[model samples]
Target: MKLKFDSFLLALLIAIGLAYFFPQAVLFQDGKFIEAVTTVGVSLIFFFYGLKLSITDIKYGLKNWKLHVVVQLTTFMLFPLLVLPFKSFVANAVQENFWLSFFFLAALPSTVSSSVVMVSIAKGNVPAAIFNASVSGLIGVIVTPLWMSLFLDFHTENVFGDVYWGLIREIIIPVILGLLLQRYLGGWASKYSIRLAQFDKTVILLIVYSSFADSFSSGVFRTISTSYLVYVFIGVSVLFALIYGILYVLTKYVLKFSVVDQITAIFCGSKKSLTHGSVFGKFLFLNNPSAGLYFLPLMIYHAFQIFLVTIIARRYHRRKEEESQ
Candidate 1:
């Protein structure tokens, strides 16, 4: 499975490389058609996310109410608050829109499938991960916008108010409908989960490509430097480690959960969803040219978390082996 994931990632890299090198070859170089394709890809991602989620699991997930609340609070509230201070330092170094973009990234929803997948790989509590992750998205509708209103002072330039409803319609509604339909098709959804997840990943890669491609084609890259972004990337890495590390310590002394539940709480608690980051950026920063800049931290962070957690998950696999011994 690890080998196959490496292969999939390699293929995705190759696909992105092609988009980078031959920008014209990117499906629909014309902005109108490309936008349509982007919309479709976004919808597909949410639709599959809905299908992959189970209705029965949701009921069971609600039983662990405390875990869900903390995870959401951290993802939507505390994480954003933590980044607010850094804005003053980066203010002179980075552009306002760029700073706004990253600030918005921090407030977006937590991931669902990958969080649960990481917990499962680490032999953690799958059910709790599912519930906490799902709950974040549902709560994000209110939380995300409120988070934006705090920092979003310039309505004319950012146009966040106009774009907010579009995003809620595109991403949120589909996910809720998917959850509601779970009773009828949840089993079928499970059977095809592997295929659907791959499809979803493809959609995400497409989003990444289109996002960067749009910025590249518009000459947005010229305004930014690789060195500056490197610093932001480092910030993202440190932030990722900090969140997971804090979760680990809290789970140990505070949560007092079993090993599996601890791992679930840590991974689920530490994550911010890239899919939501992308979808929201499209809505939240529509007129803003540096949309990709905001997501830059998160993209790097997402890639980092996925590979790093795999290593951590393997340790748990070995621990399970020793316990069985």
Candidate 2:
């Protein structure tokens, strides 16, 4: 078998490089034109997300309460706990920004598209994957900010309220609008899912470019060494492996789930969403120049998970084929 490179990952790297070289072009100047476009883009992304959801599918998915519970717990609870213990170590060995980045990565919800796609690839519970991944974003809208508030002292007087309002405006409201209009738009949305997905990726890339531009302009990357970046990569890789391993054992042996459910658990439980990370970070870290550092780990984790999970999904796909044969 031949290895395939992810073109989006390449695009992401290019976006970052462009930001570093042409910060002025990408940076949001006083929340002007670029900001307006990005804000609308993000809202539309969620709106499409809502349009794609099927209430019937989610209701049916709820029957697999055990699997749903495990995946959500692994995403919101276990992942954060794994990183919390390293607080003291990170404080001593790494910068506060990096520690915050790692914690942010841990606290994010699972990716909506990739989790479902990976589970489908492994011949897992597709409906459940869809339900879990969709619900996870909604849950993260509430949970992730609360988790971050525990550590970050916001510059605003009522940061939590502001964060909630941001989510309501940028994410929740648009999602609800999409849901409301789903009856009329659902068919079109489904028909254009691939195109909409490309749109989503493009919006995310624009966000990435803007974020890195801000960071580069502020000279945030200058403080960190290449070796430190390597350390972060190793740390993120280990975190992914640990979660994947734990979920594997728990789903397969402890829960005694079917192979399909096991595949869903491992894939869904072990992933994080860069989309949510970027969108949420915009509001949470507003005017914070170090915002770029916060996204670094998320980008790394996103790329790493795609690479690792593709291999795992392919292996499981092959195993299923052989067994059927």
Candidate 3:
């Protein structure tokens, strides 16, 4: 079988190339116009997200308390802990920025669309996948920043003020508004989920372009060598492999979950969201020159996870089909 390349991955590469070649066009300007655009895009993305979420779905998912606990712990707690040990190693080897980027990737929530899709393909617990994927992003809005603040002094003056404000304005409020209007707009949102997904990817590409443009212009990438980037790729791959293997064993053996729930746990727990990474990075790393480098691990991990998981998901799907037949 021929290997297929994802269009979004291709688009991400093109965005980076454009940012490198034409930094002026994509770089954020002094007036904050581009920043405002990204903020609006983020709000709309969350709004649409809320519109699609069903309260009943969440309630159904919560019935599996053990499964939810495992998934959440794997996403927020275990993932970060796995990276914490490498802090001094990464800092000494590359720079503080590389460690920060890796930590940021670890702190992010799971991918909503892809995780659910993979679970469904693998004949996993679809409702639980949807619920976990959706709730993980919301949880990350609060949890991710808290994790970052533990290491980086986000607000030297106001402490929690700025971070909370950003989350409220950009993520929480919009999601709440969407939920309030879900009765009226939920159907419409569901009908146009594909379009909204495209919109989300477009906004992410814009953010990527602006970030890399700034990094390129500021010579941030210059500090790192090509060899270092290869190491980062290896590191991300190893991280994914380790997490995936552990989750597989825990869900399959220790937890004694069904095959379906095992698939959901492994996929949802192992993946991270590029969507949240892009938008949250904009707010968290504002005015910081290392912003582009901050997204590097996420981008690489996003591509790698999708590619590797697709093959695994397809194999599971095929096995299920054979068994049923």
Candidate 4:
């Protein structure tokens, strides 16, 4: 029952601690500097993602239409629906913010690396996992915003229009450009995938640090008590378990998937992407005082999912080995 702690999760905790104690460190409190750095970093992250993407794997993955549909619906639709009922109970702005954080966590995409890696470890359908994970991010770029627009009204004039435009400029355009050059550079991207992943985590850490720094400096967390964070942690835990459990039943019994496909379905369907959470939050919550509050649930969920899934994947791996004998 021992679970290994991910170093990046540790780094995330350290990033938050640093932001708390030294909000102004590296001039992050100034806003514009960190904004500029993270903006470029976000684009580069997506670009590298595009460069490393495999069109063949996606095509191969599409053959499993039933599994793909189930996983996609779980990720984009069911997760949000599970949380939507609570919105009616949001009695005040503070409650709404917490609710919105939960909604955002529900709306996010699946993790690409972790989902595929875990599926592989569990002797699951790896190609489908890769395809589902990759497509989930692209889908989230559009879907996440539309979901948020239903609940959030921006201060800017022409808010939705501006948000879409920023998404195109910062995320979509870079991905497109990277895909275009992927034919020439894709190999290089794959060769350096591990390094690029490190680069991605670095950007995410910077974003986390900058976000919390702003929140800390502006006294945003003062509005939030330690007890509220416990509630959020419990909230995300329930959301993760609920979705994971639902996918398990649907894939195992209803869909009658092979154990491999079931593994892919549950793992890819239940996870959310912190990388996307960080990048999309920058645009969605731009200059909002509560930006850090919005990200808190996602960070907690990201860490929790990794811990829980690693255990599940390892057990599946062990069972497969035993059966092979």
Candidate 5:
């Protein structure tokens, strides 16, 4: 039987509580250790991600190019443009540079598994969704930092130096290696994907835990207030709704895609990439434990997008079934 993904989300919440409640945990005792664990754990997650994708999947994915472009462009480009105008408004009202970095997070790639899985579950174009998610990821590694440099000004300070390529190598290079060795690895990959899906959720929880742990360590939680939390939630909820609404109008009317493709586009387009946001965020805020600052606003958006898209995907799936009947 397939496990309920909600269980994983709940487990992640529990893990976050573990890290938050135990601020002085051993992982956070040494900065270097926490960094090392985060690095290793994230790489392992990507390695398994690579192994999970196969040659057949890639070929299958290539068939739906329109679905790929529309969804990915919306994800890695259009969403950021929508969020950019909010930057000046937020800048006028808010003073936190880290919160502003959330604008850049909106421009990054889609998540690997969730984007693909959500579309698949909704009976959309799974192959194209998977391909778009993976390609957008590869593009994000390069394009994201470049956009950051152009917009966030990380390049001017030379913060884009050293060991960052290791992140690329771990995720992209391994996938290429897996593709090259698919004949041998593909069999093992299918067997482990489920277990690794659990690991994927755990890895994300670890990331959230470790990151929030740093904020806790630095007493950053004190800086955040209940009113601020309420605003963040409300703002993210609005943004999620707006993105989905815009994409739905475009896909449903302007493009006239099949209902499945429409859901695929909106779901994939409307979501932000937490994996890249958290990982690349470290580079953007290097040497600062408060780096979680960049992550904070984007984190609310991630949760909001998933919740909103789940409802939309289910509705689309039901409509699809009724039409088929």
Candidate 6:
């Protein structure tokens, strides 16, 4: 079998390189144009997310309460707990932000599209995968901010209120509008899911470009050395492996779920969403020049998870085929 590379990952790296060479181009006429475009793009992405969300599927998959519980807890609780112990090790503002970047990655929801795709590839519980992946984003809208608030002290006097307000305006409200219109346009959304997914990625690429541009322009990355970046990348890879291993043990032994559910649990629970990270980072880290740095670990984790899960999914696929044969 041949190895496949993710084109979007390549696109992201190219976006960063373009940002480095042409940071000035990211801003046109006081930067208002690009900012407005990205803000609207972020809202529309979530609106489409709500439009594609299936209430019936969620209700149907509710029967697998144990499976849902394990996935959600691992996503919202276990991942953060594993990283929380390192807070004491952070000694400076720079280190704190870097550590917070990892924490942010830990707090994020699982990827909706990739989780379901991987589980399906492994012949796992598809409906449950769909349901868990969908519900995880909704849960993240609330829980992720709460996790950040515990450690982050914002520059604003009304920081807490501002955080939720931004979330409500940029994410929650758009999702609600999409949900309300789902019955009318949901079929159309489903019909164009592939196109819509492409749109989602375009917006994410734009966000990545703008963020790195701002960081480069502001000279934020100069503070971070080459060795530090290497450590961060390694830490992200290790974090992925640790979570994957723990979820595998939990689903197979502690929970004693079926092989299919085990596959779903491990895949879903161990993944993180770059889409959500981009949108949520915009609101949560607004006006922070080093925002791109916060996204570094998430970008790494996103690429790493997809690559690793694809390999695992293929192995599982082969094993099932062998058993049947």
Candidate 2: which pairs clash? none
Clashing pairs in model 3, backbone N/Cα/C closer than 3 A: none
Q: In order, what is each prediction's RMSD in angstroms?
A: 2.9, 1.5, 1.6, 1.6, 3.1, 1.4
TM-score of each: 0.87, 0.96, 0.96, 0.96, 0.87, 0.96
**Model 4 poorest 10 in a row by lDDT:** 25-34
Cα-lDDT of candidate 6: 0.90
List, residue by residue over 106-210, the lDDT tens digit for candidate 3: 999999999999999889999999899989998999899899887777767775678778878888899999999999999999999899999999999989988
Mind giving the per-residue lDDT tens digits that candidate 2 earns over 159-237?
A: 7798889888999999999999999999999999999999999999998888888889988888889987998899898
Kindly list the per-residue Cα lDDT of model 1 for residues 1-325, writing each as its tens digit: 3522555556556655665675564445456676777688777667667867766777887887767766777787778877788677655535665566667767878888789888887888788888888878767767787778776553675565566667777777777777777678778888988888777777767666666666666677788777867777777777887778777887788877778878887788778887777676676655455555676777767777788887888888788989999
Pitting candidate 1 against candidate 5, the one with the higher lDDT is: 1
lDDT of 5 by residue, 220-245 (tens): 66776687767767767776777778
Query: Which ten residues in a row are the worst by lDDT in model 2?
Result: 86-95
Error of 1 at 246 (Å): 1.6
lDDT of 6 by residue, 77-190 (tens): 999999999999999988987899999999999999999999999999988999999989889988998998887775558887888788788888998999999999999999
- Runs of candidate 5 with Cα error greater than 4 angstroms are 1-5, 26-29, 90-94, 151-153
Q: Which stretches of candidate 1 lie over 4 Å from their true place?
A: 1-19, 22-30, 93-98, 152-154, 157-161
Q: Which has the higher lDDT value, candidate number 1 or candidate number 6?
A: 6
Each candidate structure's count of clashing pairs: 0, 0, 0, 0, 0, 0
Clash count in backbone of candidate 1: 0
Give the alpha carbon lDDT tens digit for every residue of 141-235 in model 4. Answer: 89999999888886459888888888888888999999999999999999998899999999999989988887888898998788999999899
Better of 1 and 2 by TM-score: 2
Cα deviation at 94, candidate 1, in Å, is 2.6
Question: What TM-score would you give candidate 1 relative to the actual structure?
Answer: 0.87
User: Residue 95 in candidate 2 has what lDDT?
Assistant: 77
